[model samples]
Target: MKILLATDAYSVIVNGVITSIKNLRRELISMGHDVKILTLSSNRHSYIDYDSNVVYLGSYDISKIYPDARFSLSYTNPLIDSILTWKPDIIHTQSEFTTFSIARKIANKLDIPIIHTYHTLYEEYTHYFSPSERIGKYLAKKFTKRIYHKSTCMVVPTLKTYKVLKKYGIDENIYIVPTGLSMDKFSIKYPKEELELLKEELNLPLKSKILISVGRIGKEKNIEELINYLTKMKFKNIHLLIVGDGPYKNTLANLIKDYNLNNKITFTGLIPNDELNIYYQMADLFVSASTSETQGLTYIESLANGTPILCRDDECLEQTVINNYNGFRYNSFDEFSEKLKLILNNNGLYKNFVENAVISVNENFSSTTFANKILEIYEKYIK
Candidate 1:
C-alpha cells in the first residue's frame, strides 16, 4: 500500500508527531508498504530528517506572527497537486485545520479513503488567540467540527481524548492508536556511571536530584505555574531540567531569574531524539504539568526508560499512569510538591514505581503493539 501522511505542524522539533510518523513509516515500510509525508516547512528546518520525501507545502515565518496561527492556513493547491501525482492508496492527515481539510478534499476527488489523526485538541490553542477562553473554545470547536466531519475516520491517541472529541459531536469512527516509544532504544539504562558523566557535562552537582520536564515551553503548557510552584516549595538539593524550547523560553528564563532559582533550574533547549533516551534514563524523575496534551508521549518515554512520572491528575495522565502503580497524579501544586518531596526522600517507593513503570509501559504501549494496531486499522480501510 502507498500511504501519504498530511500534517499541519510537521517537523522534527515538534517531538511527538514527528517521532510517531517516523516510527509508523518505518513499521509500515518493514511490512512492505510505501509511505510519504506532506507538511509545512518552518524557517530553520533544523530538525527535519532528509531520508523521506516530505513535500513542503507552506512556510512559517516566526518573526511575523504567533506560532500557533502561522501553520493554520489551508494551503491546499500544492498538496492537491502532490496527491494527484502520488496517487496514494490512503491519505492519513494529522491535523484538522489545513492539512486534514486539504487531504479530505483530495481523497474525495481521487476516491481514496481518508484517515484523520487528532493529535491535540484545537481548543488548547485558544490561549494563543485572545484572552477570552470561552470565545476561543467556541471558535476552535466550530472549525474543528466543520473539518473533522469530512474525514472517513479519526484517530485519537487516548480514550479520554476520544471522549472529549465525541462530546463535541465528532462522531466519526475513532481509532485509539497512541504514540509509542522505541523500547529497544530506551530502557532502564539507570547507568550511574553515565549519569555521573552527564551531570559533569551539564555542570550540575553530583548530588543533585534531577526533576526533568520534557515538552514545549509554551503558555498552554503551564510551565510558569510549575516554576512558581517550585519556587514556593524550595526543596533542597533539587535541580530543574527543562528539555524543550518554544516561544515561552525567554519568559521562563526570566521567571527563573526573578524567582532567584538560577542555580536550581537549567534549560537544555531542544535535546535530540537519540539523546532523549539517555536523559530519560539519567533523570531521577519525570514531571509533566501540561494539561493540553491529547496523549503525553514523554510520560510513556519516561516509563520506557524506567523513570517514574509525576503529572497532574488529568484524563490523559490517569489513562497512562495507574495512580501509585507506574506514577502518581496531584490535583494541586501543593499536593504535587508534597508527592515530589516524598518520592525524592524515599528510595524504596521510588524503586517500586520505576519497576512498575517499565512493566506497565512495555506491556501496553510498546511500538510493536502500536504499529500492529495501526497496520490493522490501515488494512481495514485500504481495501
Candidate 2:
C-alpha cells in the first residue's frame, strides 16, 4: 500500500508526532509497504528527501509562535502535480495545520480516504499564540472541531485525547492507537568506550545518581518545577540532566541560577535521535513533570532502555506508568521528591522498577505492533 503521512512538524523539528511518524514509516517499509511523508521544509524552497521518503513543501519560519517550526506556503503547482502523480492510496495526517489542509485537498481530488491522528492537546498550548486563556481554549476547540470533523477516521494516542475530541463534539470515528517506539533503537548495544567518553565530555559525575528528562525545554514541559524540586531537596550526589533544546532554555537557565542549582542541573541541548539512547542508558531514572503530553514518547523510550520513570501523574500516562509497578507517579512536588528519595535509596525496589520497565515496553509498545495496528486501520478505509 502507498501511504502518505502529512504533518506540519518534521525533520529539523523533533517532537513526539514526528517521532511517531518516523517510526511508523520505518516499520511499514520494513513490512513491505510503501510510505511517504509530506511535511514542511526548513528551507525557503521545497524539495524531496528521496532517501528518507519525504516530500517537503516550501515554508517560512514561524519560530516566534512555535520554536523551530515553519508555516508552509500555498502549495506550488509542481508540488501538487507531483503528489497527484504519486497516487497515494490513503492520507494520514499528523497535524491540523497547513500541511493538513493540503492533505484534505489531495485526498478530495484523488478520492482517497483521509485519517488523522490527534497528537497534541491544543488547549494546553495556548500560551504560544494567545494571551487570554478563555479566548485560547475557545479558539482551540473551534479549530479542533473544524479539522477533525473532516477526517474519515481519527486516531488518538490515548483515551484521554479521545475523550477530549468527543467533548468537542467531533462525531468522527475515533480509534485509540497508542504511539509505538522502535524498541531496538534504544536496546541496541552501544560501544562502552563511546558511552563513557560522552559522559565525560558532558561532565556528568561518575558517581552521582543521574535523573534525566528528554524533551523540548519548553514552558509546557513544566521543567521549572523539576528544577525547583531539585533545589529544595539539595541532594549532594544527585544530578538532573535535561536533554533537548527549545525557546524556554534561557528562561529555564535563569531559573536554575536563581535557585543556585548550577551544579545540580545540566542541559545537553538537542542530541541526535540515533545517539539519544546513550543518554538514556546512562541514567538511573527518567523523570518528567510535564502534563501537556498526549502520549509521552520519552517515557516509553526510557522504559525500553531499562530506565524506570518518575513522572507527575497525568491521564496520558495512566496506561504506561503504573504507580509502584514499572514507575511511580506523583501529584505534587512534595510527592515527587518523596518518591524520588524512596526509589534512589531502596536499591532492591529500584531494581524491580527497572526490570518491570523492560517487560512493560516489550509487551505493549513494539514498533511492529504499532505499524500493524495502523495498517489495519488503513486497510479498513481503503476501497
Q: Which has the greatest TM-score? A: 2
**Model 2 Cα lDDT, one tens digit per residue, 198-231:** 7789898878999999988789999988888888
The alpha-carbon deviation from the true structure for residue 230 of candidate 2, after best TM-score superposition, in angstroms, is 0.8
Q: Please count the clashing residue pairs in each candidate, in the order shown.
A: 0, 0
Runs of candidate 2 exceeding 4 Å displacement: 190-194
What is the overall TM-score of model 2 with all chains considered together?
0.96
lDDT of 2: 0.87
**Candidate 1 residue runs with Cα over 4 Å from true position:** 43-50, 62-83, 187-190
- List all candidate RMSDs to the true structure: 2.8, 1.5
Worst 10 residues of 1 by lDDT: 41-50
User: Which pairs clash inside model 2?
Assistant: none
Q: Best-fitting candidate, measured by lDDT?
A: 2
